[model samples]
Target: MVVGATGTTGSRVVARLSAAGLRVKATSRHATPVDGARPVRFDWNDPSSFDNALEGTDRIYLVPPPGSPDPAAVMLPFLRQARAAGIRRAVLLSASAIPLGGPAIGQVHKALPDLVPQWAVLRPSWFMQNFSGNHVHARTIRADGTIRTATGEGRVGFVDAEDIAAVAVHALTDAQAPNTDLIITGPQAVSYGDIAAVLTEVTGHTVTHRRLTHESLRDRLAADLPIEFATMLADLDRAIAKGAEDRTTDTVQRLTGHPPRDFRAFAEREMRRPRSRPV
Candidate 1:
């Protein structure tokens, strides 16, 4: 089962699993159609939708409720139900900043090992898609040639979603489960300014990184998101500024036998894709 089947990493995982000829149940709120896989309706807030999605599935890919400050409140009940339904393995999509028992999805990460016989948690660094895909950074870049953030001179091993999914596939399909959290990252550590320069080069338009204060960024995001979630995101940027995400690892290369895609290559590839309007 692939939860959040329409999302960034989830969609890629579904495609990869289908291409590999694995039987997959793609779950979303609407039972949306996904090519080469079965579509099942599953809502995070609705426990009634859980049983049908769990039927006959031994492995599951979990995507936590996006933007929810307290995802454990909704996710834990379904996870317990999944355990009772005979699902043996689970792969959770988490973030680099969130460690086991830290906050939000971290609560799930801390509880996963005891809930399932086999499990792996992916703690990937910031995504490169934030600048090239349909994200706030991409939207801002396209609208006014600027990318805004609170990360001041802080560098991140920004990873590509494709690489993240590849590692996820390995975790899901390997006969032996990783049974640990993997810190996935790209090959290089770069700042937002560096990312802006790369976007300028790949998109044929000048782009600039605009740094803002933590308070300012929080206020900006709170306009559209919950206050607590906005505060957490802003705090993550503050943590980055302090060099929390400054390191890179060989997890991707070791597992996939291919070097993770660097930011420049990711930008160029996305620009070359059809209908890639934003860099």
Candidate 2:
């Protein structure tokens, strides 16, 4: 069972699991269908949806909702429900910055060991999907050839969502490892400038990373997000600027037996279409 099946990473997990001929149940808030899979309704706001989603499932792909203030409050109860429903194995989608007791998904990680027999927490770096998915800053970058962020010249090891899905499939299906945190990343660490260069090469336009103050970023995002969320994002940018996300890791290659895709390759693939200024 894959929670958040309609999401960027969850959809990939559902597809890969189904392609491998695994018995898969995919969950979506709406009735979005996954080919050759059964669709189940799952809303984080509703607790009753938890039991039905976990019924008779042995393995689950879990992704908590974004910006959830109390992830443990929501997830711990669901995990207990999953355990009671006989779900044993779980692959949790966590973030690179969140440690066992850290903020956000850390609450889930810290609680999982007591509830499930086997599990894997994927602590992956910034996703390449932020470029093509719903990330407003990345979309702005693609359109305007400029990415404005408070993160100034800090390098990040951005991993592809496909690679993350692949690793999740391995952990869910195979029986090699359990109860561990996997810090996955791209093969190389590069600055946002390097990312822009790659995009420029692929799109034939000069995309660049522009530094901004935290206050400016907060102001820019104030219209679309709550003040707290905007502040958190701006603070995260400050953390990134401090080289918090600079290091590269080998967990992807170690688990998948292939080197993780680089940012250049990801940019080349994503920028295949024409580019224009932001409308």
Candidate 3:
């Protein structure tokens, strides 16, 4: 089962699992149709919707509820139900910024071992997709050639979503479940400013990084996010600026047999992809 089936990593995971000929139960709140996978209605806010999705699949790929300051309160109970329903292996997609038992999804990470027989938590670095995909950074880059953040000059490993999905597939389908937390990152660590330079030079997009103060970034995020969640996100940026996320890991290559895509490669590939014309 893949929760948040329509999301960035979740959608990719569903496709990879389905293409591998595994039965994929893809769940979204609206139960939107996805090619090559079965669709089911599931919502984090609605606990009653959990049973059918969990019972139908032996394994699950968990993507935490977006924009929630603390997802464990909702996620843990559902996970407990999944274990009770005889589900075996589960892979959870968590952020590298959040550690096991730290906060948000971390709390769920802490309880996963006790809740399920076989499980793996994928703690991936900041996504390379943040610049190329549907994130606010992508939006601002499209709108004004600017990627704004509070992360200052701090660097991030910026792993690709596809790499994350590949690792997840192996974890879910491997003969022996990894049964531990895996920290995944790209081949190199670079700052947001470096990302902007790459896009500008290689992709022909004149992008620039705009660093904001923590409070400014928080207020900007508050325009679309709950104040509490926005504050927490801004705090993550602060942590990054302190060099907390300036590290690399070889988990992607170790697990998936290929090095994670660097920011430049990711940007160039995205720029080369054919874009859809607006209707």
Candidate 4:
């Protein structure tokens, strides 16, 4: 079962698992049908959606709802129900910035070990998709050829969502649980400036990274997002400026037997895709 089946990573997980001939239950609030999988309506705020979604599924790929300030409060009850219903394994999509017991889905990461016999927490680095997806960074780049950040020159090993989904598939289907947290990352760590250069090279646009103070970044973000959320995002950027994400790991290669894609490769591929209507 894949909760948030239409999400960035969950959708890919559904496709990969279904292609492997595994029975997959793909759930979302809308219950939209996914290719080669069963569709079911599931909402974190609605407990009634839980029983039907978990029925007959042995394992699940869990993705916390987007914009959720605290995911554990919404997800833990469902997880408890899933455990009581005989679900054996779970793969949680968490973030590298949030440690187990830190914040957001981190609490779920800390709680999963005792809830299931077989489980894995995927603590992936910043996603490469943020450059192309419906995020503020992507929108800003598309609009004015600028990528704003409080990260200054800090670098991140931005892993692709495809790589994250591939790793999730392995974590879900492997004969034995990995029994540990996987810090998945791209082949290299690159700065926002480096990403801007890659975008410029690939798209023929003079994209640039605009470094801002944490306060400025937070205020700018607060225009469209909740103040608390904006503050949290800005805090992450502040962490980056302090060299929080300036590293790489081989976890993706070790688990999937293939080295993760680098930023240049991702940029090339993204530029080739059909462009979305400008924001």
Winner by lDDT: 1
Task: Put down candidate 2 lDDT per residue, 121-230, tens digits, no spaces.
Answer: 99999888787766875788757878888989888889999999988988888776457988889987778778778777777777888889989998898887777768
TM-score leaderboard ranking: 1, 4, 3, 2
- Candidate 1 backbone clash number: 0
| Top TM-score hit | 1
Evaluated at residue 224, the lDDT of candidate 3 is 96
RMSD of 2: 3.3
Model 4 residue 75 lDDT score: 85
| Alpha-carbon local distance difference test for all models | 0.94, 0.84, 0.90, 0.91
Point out the worst 10-residue segment of candidate 2 by lDDT.
Answer: 267-276
Q: List model 1 lDDT by residue over 1-279, tens digit each.
A: 999999999999999999999999999999997867999999998888999999999999999999999998988888899999998999999999999999899999999999999999999999998986689998998899999999999999999999999999999999999999999999999999999888888788899999999999999999999999999999999999999999999999999999999998888888643455786
Kindly list the per-residue Cα lDDT of model 4 for residues 176-273, writing each as its tens digit.
99978999999988899999998998898899999999999999989977888889889999999889999899988888999999888888888644
Candidate 3, residues 160-243: lDDT per residue as tens digits?
899999999999999999999999999988999998888888767698999999999999999999999999899999999999
Residue 155 of model 2, lDDT score:
83
Q: Residue 43 in candidate 1 has what lDDT?
A: 93
Q: What TM value does model 1 have?
A: 0.97
